[model samples]
Target: MKLTILGSQSPYNTTGHNCPGFFIQDNQTRLMLDCGSGSHSLLNYPNDLQNLSIILTHLHRDHYNDIYNLQYSSFVFHNQKRIEKPINIFLPSTPAKIYEDILSEQNSFAKYQIIDENSSFKIGNMNISFCPTDHPVETYSIKVQNGNRTIVYTSDSSFSAKNRLVEFAKGADLLICESSLLKEHGFPEINSHLTSEQAGIIAKEAGVKGLILNHFWPEEPVQKYVDEAKKVFQNVIPAIEGLTINIPSIEKELDERS
Candidate 1:
């Protein structure tokens, strides 16, 4: 599998760091986990984004800023190539209306189909499942599996239930989670984020092969976050844009990489 982080910041980017964007691909599937700020430019407007067809996960401007851009661009791309297949979109029920607004979608947007909890779906080479996450907004976490290989993505949310994460992450070759805090830093108002320390606990307990933390504050040195996660997970890693990680199974990727 190939995991590429297109963006890895929290707030909308104005400087260098772009918000959150990730791409995952296996033998038969290519999925864009989240499309935050600058994603449209990253994909190159009017360019062939043909490698991607499946999209899933949370709702935050930093997570979906380019929805309209993708829609408009896809329309152009499809017409140029005489493409026929509609883009398959996997979305959380919580953000359907918001997504519609963002895309200015009439007739449920163009070239895309939204999948919710009420929907059971499949993409190439894998089966996917969504879980509710602890967050200020209604959010969804996801697990994708193919044979014994597994990958879990925690878009942006609190890790209040380590067991739940472990369930999704168990035996996963990779666990892409958010480490948005340092335990002592924030109060309860923070609601839906994890400190580096808590990030460690989840990775360790879940026994994931590798723990890659994203959606972090840029102010902290990468080493600090890595060190923090290492306390619980020996294979913990701080996320960086353009980083690529490949693990065999979501469960054991850390064991080999660390």
Candidate 2:
């Protein structure tokens, strides 16, 4: 599987990156995880959404403002071709109800279904599962497995509860985590966010192949964050715009190799 940060800036827009969108592709299948505000219009690849799916972390505006755009674009770009087919959305049962109420405002989202937490499901050739995370909203961390590799994503969450994270990300090939701040200042606010130190510890304990941090605060010192994460994780990466990662897999041998 391949990963790209569609957007990674915090709500503060410190570096002008988008809020929380990330793109994942494996073989011929594609999924946009947490399509933050204004991301759908940014997808210009050929047949981008023809076989695309969306996995939302929560309903916070910063994380979901682009959903309506995704729904509208599908209809408009396909010459108003309607989707009597439902979209698969993995989310918590409660917020899933709220999502239904919100999307019901428009006819476009009438058919979508929400996959409850702890349930395993398949998308194309991938097997995926969701687990609760420590976030203000009904948030979920995703784990995906396919083609001999597993990757996990932990969207905006606090450091208070991390057991679920360790369970979900255990032995993942990559862990895409949100390190929204540096550790110098304790983040004990109402809508708290994680720090680089916390992310480092999480990844190290989970024993993932790599740890990539994202959703950085705009004005936050980038070096401070990177340096802090590096202290705990040797393979730590501070997310940069346009960065891409390909999870490794073995190439098939030709019959001639015999």
TM-scores for every predicted model: 0.85, 0.85
Which candidate number maximizes lDDT? 2
Candidate 2: tens digits of C-alpha lDDT, residues 60-164: 878877777776665555554543333444444456566866556453432355655766878888898887777777788888898678888998788776777
> Candidate 1: where are CA atoms >4 Å away?
14-16, 44-48, 82-84, 106-109, 117-120, 188-190, 249-258
lDDT of each: 0.68, 0.71
How far in Å is the alpha carbon of 101 misplaced in model 1? 1.1
Please give the lDDT score for candidate 1: 0.68
On TM-score, the leading prediction is 2
RMSD of each: 3.2, 5.6
Candidate 2 residue pairs that clash: 14-218
Candidate 1 displacement at residue 229 in angstroms: 1.1
